[model samples]
Target: MARKTKEEAQLTRQQIIDAARAVFHESGVSRSSLDAVARVAGVTRGAVYWHFKDKTELFHAVREEVSSPLLARSHAILDSGDYADPLDAVEAAIVDFFRILEDCPTLRQVLEILILRCEYVDDFVDVKAEVMQPAFEFNERVAAAYRRAAALGTLRPGLEPESAARDTLAFTTGLLHLLLGTRDANGIREQVPAMVSAHLALRRR
Candidate 1:
């Protein structure tokens, strides 16, 4: 057999992921079978196994693809640029996250898996932990941003930015689950920006 080129390997991996997304979207992750994903991708079962160890790993990969750009943009925004107010950076980050989910269905599926189906699974915590790393990092930045805002006297006296960031993100994650879980998955796109603005309004201006 001819050795597969790197491009070919990546194409196969993406094919599997795309197939899995279609299957999961149509029937949901809980009901979609690996065999069904394999058939959709027109690949062998062994190929799916070769690309991803199991459903969770595949889901994780999808989540990574969905969130990686947002993660990079967020880190860049927080780490660089002289902002008029540190809190503005926080608002920017929040707005970015809200907009990202509206644009990325794969990431939205990650939220759905956590809030909708994983509630009944024993390893739900594990799944949550695996997928929450990006949120945690963003919260860390929020905390640091909060401190900066506090130093500038722009933020309220008692609020803890770091802890608040963590809390706010956790709250928003749950909110996203509930909101998206009940409504048509794609419908949240039109509303997340306003929802984000409302949540940010809770902070002292």
Candidate 2:
């Protein structure tokens, strides 16, 4: 075999990751094999192994590939500092998440693979931590927004930022689960504005 340049190696690695996404999306992770991914990517089994130690590592890589962009968008929204009503800013961020999911099919598929296709038995419990880091950051952003709302007297006087943050986080989690379960072709994209409105209405002064 001819030697591959570093650029060729990186391209091959990404091709394998793309193939893994398709394979994992089509067949659950436990059922999908690196050989199947290699075939899909038009690479040798040795090529797949060169880039990833095993299926588990490849799965994590696939997730990281999709997740980094999603988290970056979330971080950008949190860092934008554009909304006068911090609560409105927080709601806009959540709405933007749904818009992203609706707008990007590749991303939506990756999220679907993570949410509906994968199981977390045994060592796979660690797989969940990959999800928690952004969630924790998201929670902090919501908490900060709530604190800003409180300071501005937009929030009901007695409302606590911590409690609001926790409730909003839990609500967002439930919304995502239901959205996945329903799998409505265009689900939540339209509903988010009204939902956020009703949610914030409850806490408004």
Give the root-mean-square deviation of each candidate in angstroms: 3.1, 2.4
Q: Best TM-score goes to which candidate? A: 2
C-alpha-based local distance difference test score of model 2:
0.84
Write the residue-wise lDDT of candidate 1 on 73-170 in tens digits. Answer: 88877765667777777777767776776677776775665455444355344777766788788888877877887888877778878777777777
List clashing residue pairs in candidate 2: none
lDDT per residue, candidate 2, 1-205, as tens digits? 3456877999999999999999999998878888999999999999999999988899989888878888788767766678778877777788888778777888878888888888876657888887667788888888888888999998888999989988988888787777767846364656777887788778788
Model 1 segments more than 4 A misplaced: 1-4, 119-125, 184-195
Q: What C-alpha lDDT do the candidate models reach, one value each? A: 0.74, 0.84
lDDT of 1: 0.74
